[model samples]
Target: MLAVSRSVTRARIAARLPIVERTTAGRPTPTRTTKERTMPQHPKGSVLEFDLRGTGSGVLQEVAIAGSEHAVRAEGHPAFGGTDSAPSPLDLVLSAYVSCNQVTATIVALGQGITLGAFEGRVQAELDNSVLVFGAEGDGTFQRLTLTVDLETELDDAAFDAFVAEVARRCPLTQLFERAGVEITNAWTNRALARV
Candidate 1:
């Protein structure tokens, strides 16, 4: 230990000592200054949640939806009747297929660096039943969707056809809906234990 007297104790040091500073042969020590990896935190997540209620059917659920500009649901069905005038699940689904086609077309156009002036899709869904009755099985269903696209970006016919081809390939719900397979598994709940 070095000698320390009463004078050294009373004298104030000119500089503070660094904690365990190492001085290797010639290379300087590495330091992390202002390079810390920090990611920005989102203040809030998405603000959409559809409230689903049981429609008391085999595989049907009533969704009380929001995010519409208006304030009343289209039909006043007690289950799907929201404060706003929007369509029901089936209606929304029909519209979703049409809307999805439009969106997919836009994405396809952007990927190919083309510009679409106007795009509109019209869809008609038929139950094919003689009459509308509650829980009546369909005779056979048929649907037709017509899409009209206007071009202002001056793309050729082949390019436009390619865009439509991509839309037909991609659009999701319709392309996979017919060919999709589903598996249902039955499980008992806590309350079902009593009955069992």
Candidate 2:
């Protein structure tokens, strides 16, 4: 019995394990630890919870986050029997993606002691709505996504590329979309920062 228990423990230790860490936004992320370990170690991290409340009526939906007074509204297109008063769900998602990238970039720049100015981003996505409209037997996710970012900074081309790579690697939304099998294309343009 002691030998069997030791063998099981050794096998478990040889397997790859995930280490959960917290991001600056208080979100938990699973990352790969060392390749080999001697013993199992537990993480002493606190979990953060985010709650959202939403109300929908006639193709119009309003959502509010917990502990926040601000709310956002979304509506379907007029062709979909909606009043078209607000942006569609996909539009909101794209907006969030773009903003999240910018936010991540800012955080990375601050950590690296880099200065930035006049940042802008544009995103386009190709999606098939047949699954939602006709209940087709296919995925309803975006087929392809392209994001272009324009930043005014003093960093050289090589440094700019490295910075963008780091931002993409650290951005949670980018990770989520890529893991979901979305084909993403990102282009970054750097310009000289204006001197005051």
Candidate 3:
């Protein structure tokens, strides 16, 4: 049942966007017509800035925001010559993407007068290690990413679709990946909200 939902979501996304062709490096190269090449608009004074500081040596770092009581420890993977202590930079990036989507979804649901239950997200990425590890001539970004989200909601099929679409449009992290030319697919599963 979940697999069928994912298939439908993928089909919907593919049908709405312009056709994309795969490059020799297995990355997607999107093709758009003149009519479809409009840029997104940002209203005045809408920009938000964030700042953080980190200190580390030998592929391990402790990062924290100013005036915050919490700090995050990050380390490089063992393959990159660092002790496998904490999440690597790439892992943090994927974590940001998932958390950003959930936050955006909560805001969207609130605005739409909807209530949400338990939510979970998973991200799978294909990284081209050749560029990072070896002196490769290609881009080092993830070749592809798949984000699957499971949410318990009471909305119907059409409402769920609209909610998901709106969340995608408003998610800053999603915009970052799309603008960077990363091939990303989002599969959302809307489960029935359990009543207690």
Q: How many clashes show up per model?
A: 7, 0, 0
Which window of ten consecutive residues has the lowest lDDT sum in model 2? 1-10
How close is every model to the real structure, measured as TM-score? 0.44, 0.74, 0.75
Cα lDDT tens digits, model 1, 60-148, are 34443223333322433234344334465556666777777666655565556554554445655543333333446643333333334
Task: Name the lDDT value of residue 120 in candidate 3.
Answer: 90
- Taken over the whole model, the C-alpha lDDT of each candidate is 0.43, 0.76, 0.78
Q: Candidate 2: which pairs clash?
A: none
Give stretches of model 2 more than 4 Å off: 1-48
Q: Show where candidate 3 strays beyond 4 Å.
A: 1-46
Least accurate 10 contiguous residues by lDDT in model 3: 1-10
Give lDDT tens digits, candidate 3, residues 118-188. 78999999988899999799888888989999998989999999999999998999999988889999999
Model 1 CA deviation exceeding 4 Å by range: 1-86, 130-143, 148-152, 177-196
